[model samples]
Target: MSDDTDDAQPPRRLNSLEDRNAVVESALDRAIKRGDFDDLPGRGKPLTGLHGSSDPDWWIKQKLDSEGINGVAPAAFQLRKENAVLEDTVDAFTEESDVRDYLAGFNARVREAVMDLREGPPVFTPPRDVEKEVAAWRRRRNAMKNDSVTEAEPGDPEAEPGYQPVDPESVGSPRRWWHRFRR
Candidate 1:
């Protein structure tokens, strides 16, 4: 009876490519049914940098950007960003001495970074001419002052009597809650 039962069973064939695919698909379906992937981060977000480059490091770069990491940026890139905001930084200071000192420090750092031998994209920023920048800053400040004066003059048809332009710089810096607590 045992020999008859053994002979009655058919031989099992090795799984083919299609059979393996079906097995994987079934396993994925089971996982989905169990809500295994419901809470994953970036679930509906479109993939980034997919078409930007074929570089093998694309995934790593994407991960860094997604995490708001700035330490990974190239030195040249960081310098370029700083250069772009340099004018705003200079304009934020109301004193000529402060502006000159800031520009001098910035130029020195740029020169030092340019002299470094580490391989990266070339720094394209030229050192700022302090005198020329100071002149330009003066011109801008004078123009703003002239505009405010002209707007307030009584001779102008649209002038509001007793209207005075507020100097934004005179406002003291805002204090944070932590500062108040410390005091």
Candidate 2:
């Protein structure tokens, strides 16, 4: 006697600004690594919506040709820009004593309201390329365990050059099933 229409799933939760922040960081990282700051001030101009900002290179050249400081021009500009972004991020987070007192603050009340707002949504099974992911993982694990490609004998001059030792940092990862998980 149950209707399937009553089992519809809820819409996904997402924040567009968070996605934009990630993209900006990615592009900024590539630009910084390549020393592509020729577009310095402009690197984040449109991205920051900072008006046709002063050119970073221009400021550097001016400072160098006049003041002889190797790091001041661009560094100073960046300091100002970072200061603004920090101010904006702070402004976005409202002052809330709400979470300070368990039964008092807005944070607790908001959380309660949200829980009430959500009548448990219907669950939906998502079709995923689990087989492909499994194959990829197997290929990776096999590669990690099969790194010896040389026929050289141990400690011989013919021994293969030092192994590019695997980092302990990269040796184990949470994604691997070998990592202990709480049942």
Residue range 1-183, candidate 1, lDDT tens digits: 667887785754537988778778988999999999998999999976667677987778778888988756677777788889887888888999998999998889788879985958888888899999999888888887898776545576458657577779867987677897784
lDDT of 1: 0.82
Residue-level lDDT of model 2, residues 9-46, one tens digit each, is 57545479897788789889999899887765656545
Best model per TM-score: 1
**Each candidate: what lDDT?**
0.82, 0.48
Pairs that collide, model 1: none
Residue 58, model 1, lDDT: 77
TM-score of candidate 1 to 2 decimals: 0.44
